[model samples]
Target: MNDQHIVKSYDRDLEAIQATILKMGGLVEDAILLGSEALTARDIEAAERVRKGDKAIDALEEQINEEVARTIALRAPVSRDLRILLSVLRLAASLERIGDYAKNMAKRVTVLADTRGIEGADASLRRMAREVQGMLRDTLDAFVRRDAELAREVLARDESVDQMYNALFREILTFMLEDPRTITPAMHLHFIAKNLERMGDLVTNMAEQVIYFVTGEKPQEDRPKGDRTAYMGAP
Candidate 1:
């Protein structure tokens, strides 16, 4: 009876940690959307709000780490249980980095606000951000469901996000080359696009972590990357 009670307590503790992860994921999703929206709308106030909201995301990550540490110390979890806790740490770290990228996107909105607007650039960026946000949402779902297939699906979708970034990079470059006056804003837009692309990569990493925990091994296949900006000599 005592052993059963102890097992129940450990399960409750794990549940609480998972709940915190879900909460953090929700905040990250919001940050990605709001950051892109703020850029598109030229809403400095909204951008500031996104920036300030990152503190909460950061706090949740720290909370998760502490909770995981405490659970590990007290439970001495081994095997699958230990893997779950370690994966939680990796997931939290990835989410925190994504939040920082969102914040970086927000930080540039004000700078671009004053620069001459490039035609359709902001709208394109918003679409890219939305794609990344969707991937993140599904990745979180896969994590919660412990669905390795769903996680693999998320991995496959990352290539689309990279393609979007590649298209945006070319478009922004064309604008910069055509009009010297538009160069400043176009650079800022490129940076934001890069941030979104990086976020996609981070989401892919999280999905791989999910697959690792679920399957007891990383995916056997190499991840497909569609971003070609590096080869194109893009800054």
Candidate 2:
């Protein structure tokens, strides 16, 4: 009876950890949405909100780390439970990175708000952000459902994000070259596009973690990277 009670308590603690991860993920998603909207709409207030939201995400990651460590020390979970706790730590870390990227994008929005608008650049960036946000949502759902196939789908979508970034990079570069006045805003747009691309990579890392958690093996093959702007001398 004592052993059974201990097992139940451990299970409850694990559930709490998972719940906390989900909550953090939700906040990160909101940050992405709000950050992108602020960029496109020139809403400084919304951008500020995204910046502030990152603190909660950071606090949650710290809490998750502490909880996982305490569980490991007290419960001495077996290999399976240990894998889960380790995955939880990795997932929270990746989520924190995504949140940080979103905050950075929001900060850029403040700069862009003062500059003259680039034609169609803001819309293109918002679209890219939406695609990334969808991937994050699906990736988290896959984690919750333990659906390896769904995770794989999320992995596949990263290529689309890369393509979008590359196209936007070229567009912004053309604008910078065409009009001297557009150079400042164009550079900020380039940075925002790069930020979104990195966020997509982080989301792919999360999907890979989901696959690892489910199958006990990392994806043996690297998905082809579509981000070729750097190699082609894109700026």
Best model number under lDDT: 1
TM-score of each: 0.96, 0.95
> Local distance difference test, per candidate?
0.92, 0.91
Displacement of residue 185 (Cα, Å) in model 2 is 0.9
lDDT of 2 at 167: 89
Q: Whole-model lDDT, candidate 1?
A: 0.92
Question: What is candidate 2's lDDT per residue for 142-167, written digit by digit as tens?
Answer: 99888999999998899999999998
- TM-score for model 2? 0.95
> 50-120, model 1: which lDDT tens digit per residue?
99999999999999999999999998999999999999999999999999999999999899889889998
The superposed Cα distance between candidate 1 and the true structure at residue 31, in angstroms, equals: 0.4
Task: Name the Cα RMSD for model 2.
Answer: 1.4
